[model samples]
Target: MNYTLDFGPVVAGLPDLLRGCAGTLFLAVVGMAIALVIGVVGVVLRESPVRPLRWAVIAFVELIRNTPFLVQIYFVFFALPLIGIRLAPTPTAIIALGLNGGAYAIEIIRGGVQSIHKGQVEAGFALGLHKRDVFRFVVLRPALRAVYPSLTGQFVMLTLTTSIASAIAAYELTSVAKLIENESFRSFEVYGTITVLYFLMSWLMMRAFGLVSRRYFSYPVR
Candidate 1:
């Protein structure tokens, strides 16, 4: 016995898959933006003098980092509604992705912040810069430069994890593949094509990250 492959259905569903790809990219972009904000705020709070705030950030980071992301999304999609905090599927998926990525980002950014020399911060303040300015220029910028590679890698993982958003009927790449497989019963072809598309997307994302690093993080040569 032998198996034969058919790609006719996959070819026909290219448009749906493309739309799904767009949705996936949208989620990743918005989710990463939210994650960056959360990470920055969390790191700042972790260093804050306020004991409750520091403990809150610690609890958030530990909870999300320790739990399964799928369960997190389910909670966002299903549980939140019961408490009068309803959200559409797309927003729910984005929030879930952001929170999940943000937890790991907090740790990554904290490591970068800690790696900065204390003298640089002191020097910034001695230059008449305000505390906020000092944190922004001397600490945050350099810290980001130090940890950007790791941060981008984490973003890549988040992008791939968008596939799980399909569980909530979020119209993304994996959802499209599932629909195509259901309609055409061409599991091998549909998934095979999606695998290629995902690879290309990941490669493009890495290239974009490279450009961002070169433009923003490059150190001046003497």
Candidate 2:
């Protein structure tokens, strides 16, 4: 009951923390972009007629989904160097986040694709659309629209997961906060401030996503 609160350190470190927020957003945005690519490509392969290809995608999803992300990052950072694939901490973190998010994204996107009626796909073909056009216009776009909420939710989670990258010395909010806490011994203040900052970042991301949904995914008005 004798502890005194101090926020001087937190206030002094505000600039660094703000930069860290930018780092966190950079990781999240780049990671989500990679995840989207993987999700779309994986879903295509998952639904392919080639049993081996489908099984390969299935195995990848299961492997990533079943494993711990910490271990995955460790493997990438440690094991890859053994094979002459050395990467810096930031790049390693980005790749790990993308793979983790992509695994879940594959399942989410697949559910959306499954919800599309088979007749719709046929109708696209009937309209003389090329195979690629049919898949893109009739299938992918609607599937994405149907699942945009889930996908964005996963991205938000992925943004939070960026904190885990701190374990590997990746330059994000939590990592910066850790340095501040170590230097200032202000665990409560440092972590408390970062917590609020994280909440704001997540809120901003949701708002941006809402604007995108309205502009791109909303159905045409009658």
Q: Which candidate is the best by lDDT?
A: 2
Cα lDDT tens digits, model 1, 1-222, are 787998999999999999999999999999999999999999999999999999999999999988999999999999998999999989999999999999999999999999999999989988999999999999999999999999999999999999999999997999999999999999989999999999999999999999999999998789
Q: Which stretches of candidate 2 lie over 4 Å from their true place?
A: none
Candidates' TM-scores?
0.98, 0.99
lDDT of 2: 0.97
* Overall lDDT per candidate, in order of appearance: 0.95, 0.97
Residue 112 local lDDT, model 1: 97
Superpose all Cα atoms of candidate 2 onto the true structure and report the RMSD in Å to 1 decimal.
Answer: 0.7
Query: Which lDDT value does model 1 have at 102?
Result: 93
RMSD of 1: 0.7
